[model samples]
Target: MIEILNPAELARAREAGALVAGILQTLRSRSAVGTNLLDIDRWTKDMITEAGAQSCYVDYAPSFGRGPFGHHVCTSVNDAVLHGRPHDYALADGDLLSLDLAVSLGGIVADSAVSFVVGGSEPPESLALISATERALSAGIAAAGPGARTGDVSAAIGAVLGGAGYPVNTQFGGHGVGSTMHQDPHVSNTGRPGRGYPLRPGLLLALEPWVMADTADLVTDADGWTLRSATGCRTAHSEHTIAITDDGAEILTAPERARV
Candidate 1:
């Protein structure tokens, strides 16, 4: 459902966004070579509980997924991209890790994701993949504002990923977030401008741009949740929850502190 949040709801949304961002930042800082994926999930649960917030994913049961997510956060590594279910695996140096999180605070929800390389080893390809998604996310946010079309945002995001020589995947993209984790007004990664739903003030959208290195195709893991690249190539994903305002789009999930 499409929801235009009221002023009071928006205030709560900001709080939810801040909590999600802080938790993700903390997780990213703690994840490194030799860290187990399950540990990341545990840490997320602790942080959410400490903040008195709820996880949007823990009970998330959608048609595409096997069953209830049963996890506090999504940990995607290397070839894995979206809906990455935490498993019994340890991260290695140079492994590209992506953490996607959604939380509810005061009954409002905010979602965000970040992809980064683990440890000191920065593989050029991995860095490039992450950079492309980050740039695309920025472009999409820049194109969002009052009266803007979802297509405009999608087009802006597509330009960056395409310019970076990455194929865009439309099977899964961004969506509206409000009282729940996912909502209406599906935001594709690539589309024609001046089309789709028009932006309105107080509207919250999670604009995510993800891409695989060589193919747009995806293969589901045996676990039935993790989506990986068809060719086993590296991948990256970047996302942010934005609020459309009279002035412009405001990034709700921006990191409070600069990455060290």
Candidate 2:
């Protein structure tokens, strides 16, 4: 379903967006070598509860997933990319970790993700992958605005990732986020511009650009949720929830300080 928030609802969305951003930043700050993935999930739960917010993922049971996702956050490491279920694993130095989170506060939702290297070992390839996804996300956001088609954002995102020599995967990409975690107007990472749904003011979209180092294929891990690169190479993902405004797009999930 596609949703458009009124001014009052948009205000609530900003609050939810800030809460999601702050928690992710805090988790990123606390993440390091030897940090247990379960511990990170626990931290996320605490933060969500303290803020009187609801996790869009903890009990999420979508058709693609095996069952209800019983975790507060997604912790993808190394080859893992999307729907990464938290497990009994400790981060290692040089490991590339990606965290995706969505939460609802005051009846509105915001979703975002960030990928980074653990410890002090920033591998060149890992850094490049992260940079590519981030740049693609920025480009996608820049292309979003009133009257813009979803494909425009997808094309902008694709230009960056494809130009960086990374293959694009359309099976799973960005989507609409609002009263619920996921919604209509599926936003692919790459598509023909001027196609698909036309964007409008008050519409909320979570544009995510993710890429694997060497392959466009994906393999599901034994956990039943984690999506890994078929070639087992490293990967990176970047995302942000933005609202289509009168003039252009407004990033709702930016860091709290960055929002002001």
Candidate 3:
């Protein structure tokens, strides 16, 4: 469902967005070499509990995924990209790790994701992949505002990733977020400008730009949740929850210190 949050609801959304952003930053700081995926999940749960917030993923059961995600956060490493279910695995040096998180606070939901190298060794390809997604995310956000079309945001994001020589995957992309995690107005990674849903004030959208190194195909892992590159090539994903305002788009999921 499409929701246009009111003033009070927007305030609650800000709180929820802050919580999600803070938790993601904290998790990124704690994820180091030798850290276990399960440990990250536990840390997420602890923080969510301490903040008196609810996880949008733990009890999530979608048609594409196995019922009940049963995890506090998504820990995607190396080839793994979306819907990465935390498992028993220790991060290694140079491993590309992507953490996707969503949470609800005061009845509003926010979602975000970050991709980074796990250790001292930063592979060139991995760094490039992460940079591309990050740049694309920024482009998408820049294209979003009242009166803008979702296609404009998609086109902007696609230009960045495609210019960087990465294949775009459309199976999953960004979406609207509000009282619930996923909502209407699906935002793809690539599309024609001046097409699709027109943006409006009070609208909240999670703009994510993800790509595989050499292919656009994806394969589900044995776990039935984790989505990996069909070629096993490294992948990266970047996302943020943005609120369309009268003036422009405000990044709700940015770190508190980064917000103006």
Candidate 4:
């Protein structure tokens, strides 16, 4: 279902969004070479609880996934891209990591993701892959506004990735988010413009642009979670939750000090 938040509800969403953004920023700060994935999950759990908010992922049992996610956040490294279930692995210096998270506070939910290299190490190929996704994300956000069709956002995102020679994956993409985590108006990474639902004010959307360096195919890991590149090529993902307003779009899921 697609949901539109009233002004008061939108205010609550800002609170939820801030928490989601702050936690992600903190996790990114704490994650480094030799950081354990499981430890990162534990820390996420603590932060969510400390903020008196609910995890939109933990206990989340979506059809695409195995059972209950049972993790506070998604920690995808290297070839892994989406739905990354935290495991026992320790991060390496050059590992490309994606941390995706969602949370509910005061009856609203916000979702976001970030991709970065561990230990500040960047290989040329990895750098290009990561850069492509970030650029695509920016394009998608720029296309979001009232009267804009969902496909417009998708097309904007696709142009960035396609122009960079990366194959787009449609199995999973962005979505409408509200009191619950996922909702309607699926936002694929690639699609024809002017097609699909027209956006409107009060609607909250989580637009994510993720790409695998080489292949469009994906393989599920044995963990019954964590979707990885079928070709084992590295990947990157970037996302933000935004609210539609009369003027334009407002990005809610950004770090506390991140410039709006």
Candidate 2 positional error at 250, Å: 0.6
Encode model 4's per-residue lDDT on 1-260: one tens digit a residue.
99988999999988888889899988999999999999999999999999888998878998878989999999999999999999999999999999999999998999999999999677988888889988898898889999999999999999999999999989899999999999998999999999999999999999999999889999999889999999999999999999988877899996762311
Off by over 4 Å in 3: 257-260
Which residue pairs of candidate 4 clash?
Answer: none
Model 2 ranges with Cα > 4 A deviation: 257-260
In each prediction, how many residue pairs overlap at the backbone (N, C-alpha, C within less than 3 A)? 0, 0, 0, 0
- CA-RMSD of model 1: 1.7
Compose the digit string of candidate 3's lDDT tens values, residues 91-130.
9999999999999999999999999999899799999999
* Model 1, C-alpha of 211: deviation from truth (Å): 0.6
Q: What is the lDDT of residue 205 in candidate 4?
A: 92
Stretches of model 4 off by over 4 angstroms after superposition: 256-260
TM-score of each: 0.98, 0.98, 0.98, 0.97
What lDDT does candidate 4 reach at residue 169? 86
User: Worst ten-residue run, lDDT, model 2?
Assistant: 251-260
**lDDT of every model, 2 decimals:** 0.94, 0.93, 0.94, 0.91
**lDDT tens digits, residue span 118-158, model 1:** 99998999999999999999999999999899999999999
Scored by lDDT, model 4 comes in at 0.91
Sum up the clashes in candidate 4. Answer: 0
- C-alpha RMSD of each candidate structure in angstroms: 1.7, 1.4, 1.6, 1.7
